[model samples]
Target chain A: MKNIYSTLPVIGILLLTLVSSALPANKPPEKGGVLPVINLPIPKNPTEKVYLGLSGDGFFKIPQIKAKVVIIEIYSMYCPYCQKDAPGVNELYTFIEKNPDLKNKIKLIGIGAGNTPFEVEVYKKTYQVPFPLFPDKDFTIHKACAEVRTPYFIVVKINDDGTHQIVHAQLGDYPGADPFLELVLKASGLK
Target chain B: MQKIRLANLIMVAGMLSVFVTVSMAFAISDAYKGNIYQVGTIKPVDSKLVVKKGNQAPDFSLPSVSGDKVTLSQFRGKKNVALSFVPAAWTPICSDQWPGYNIIKDTFDQNDTILLGITVDNIPTLFAWINQMGKLWFPVLSDFWPHGAVAKKYGVLRSNGVSERALFVIDKKGAIRYIDVHDINKRPPLEDLVGALEKLGK
Candidate 1:
């Protein structure tokens, strides 16, 4: 009876451990992968156009960002996960803006996976997202990235020759703005 | 022996407490992942729609997820209504469809339209399902109890006790302006819905 009582507690503890350590559905990806230059539309907003160091209209590419490092966030208006992470993403943008050195070196942009132009506008207005957001109404960006799930993050380092390398690619939410910013900076060798 | 029994009971209780806490944490933060069911492709659409365009929308008095009784007549003269009849809750296409409307509150308002999402699922099921979706501006009405009574009235109740993926746009004067019994496997394009609303204005 004594051994059974002792063993029951051990078994209970194991069950508790199992429940607590349930496997995550999608883990934040580790860093590495060089990507082709991604084409992007010129922001209609005049302020956004100037921030990205672009002129005229139509389309531009990721390497065109004057910053040394660029952070691209792939989100969807329909995704609850993206909605949950919006505030953190906005804070991350703000954190970069407040820092003089980081602000000039890092830039952030977002792509609305499978979202129309109108839908992307609604999301931006709803969340008050400060960064330049583009619509992928045709799922072009989504398919290019192997249909990455919403709320995915990718940090890229812009090269001298206009090509960029993917330093980090996380499939789900990050730790937080500060921690994730540190991760991005470290991954880009900026820290 | 009684003391040993007591010890075992205490251990089980402790473990349950830990388990419950972890589950609650996950539900609060990442509820979307665990709640969704991935049902693979079925028939594109299973039911034949009974109501056609220009039919006075069969009036329904279904219970909304907000604990209020919603009637189609309520919006008759005051506001136009768009009835979205989705098949079921927690399914693949059904899950994201409503949340996709979450950002377009303005578009509906501009057209003086009130969207009511109808499903055969009960209120409790809907509450649990929508908790992860944040706050939806429109009321999600349940067509359960008589089990898809409202859906059946509109002729969308499927053979499998669900509804067809359908949309009905009714004008403010209570005339059914458009009906699109969309393919169940795919989402009806937003442009089609928006165009219908825009036409209503003209």
Candidate 2:
């Protein structure tokens, strides 16, 4: 009994530390909120336009994503963490794309916060990102999203009314694909 | 027995806290997000522009984060050099600017040019802060010991100890080809720098 009591406090502290490190201390006020409907110009790339199911050239909003859940990666070509996180994000997209059950249900998109179309194209060409990425040259979307830090992840649940309910928001990058997918599944309640 | 248990618990708590604090400080991706001190807005340009397009770039040797003295004149006749001077280490715009250069290493390589990143902070400070960007392709030099001597030569040293967010493109002949004394408040568009580098060949 005495030994167990001593071990319990140690375990508790370990748990506390793990929990604190997992979530960024300065996470933006993104969770439990409705992501504003920001419009993006239709992509010029035919494949990208088809991938996002975009039609008619003017603009499109996040609610138009035909999926049960959408994972919006708010990133910047200039952000170091975003550059670091690129490969892992591409891996996540592959995992979802290859998996039949979750393929169409979960969609991945990246927003280049404060990035011009030229900058976005450079990032796409550099990272070989498979998904559609939109540019926010004037930071219109970034300001709408509370100017969140780069490499920020927002998991939004698509409701019947087409509103995006942000279920989870994480600052910094997530390590590894499997564990991060588990997190996305859990956050979006897909599992 | 109870007193010993209390002591043990206290000891464990202390160790855990230290471990956690150290972990946060040194973690690869988390370090940058943890220490971002926001400065809303400041002076656009606090120093005069002295180096003109055709002038010879003032040369200097400064210690880099990589533990070597980088001399501008060393690259003369060998490679074109783009001297990137940021205000200070760990500040808002300065922190992310160099990291942005990481993705565009090809542009510099293709242009047969090398970038030398200079900041007013000392090596120790620059090391910890630059680590936030992972390993940069270029050398990051410290202009700290002589207090922005290199920056002062280029007329980029601010009224304060910090350097101006400026970039100098010196051709193979050591003739300064381009000079951008950008607004201190924002990142100078990467296109602007790349455009300058592309212009060197012409």
Instruction: Say which candidate scores most in TM-score.
Output: 2
lDDT of 1 at A55: 89
Residue pairs in collision within model 1: none
Candidate 2, position B64, lDDT: 90
Which interface RMSD does candidate 1 score? 11.0
- lDDT digits (tens) for residues A1-191 of candidate 2: 77876676676667566544432334254779877757878777787777666676888777787788888888888788788788989999999999999988888899887677778888999999999998877665665565666777888888878777888888875776788899989988889
* Candidate whose DockQ is highest: 1
- Model 2 per-residue lDDT tens digits across residues B98-185: 8778888999999999999999999999899888788898999999978988899999999978899999999999999999998787
Q: Give the Cα error of residue B134 in candidate 2, in Å.
A: 0.5
What are the root-mean-square deviations of the candidates from the true structure over C-alphas? Answer: 14.1, 14.1
Instruction: For residues B38-117, write the lDDT of model 1, one tens digit per residue.
Output: 56556767777787888788887989989999999999889999999998888766777788787788889999999999
Q: Give per-residue lDDT, candidate 2, residue B193.
A: 90
Model no. 1, DockQ: 0.16
The per-model lDDT (C-alpha) reads 0.79, 0.80
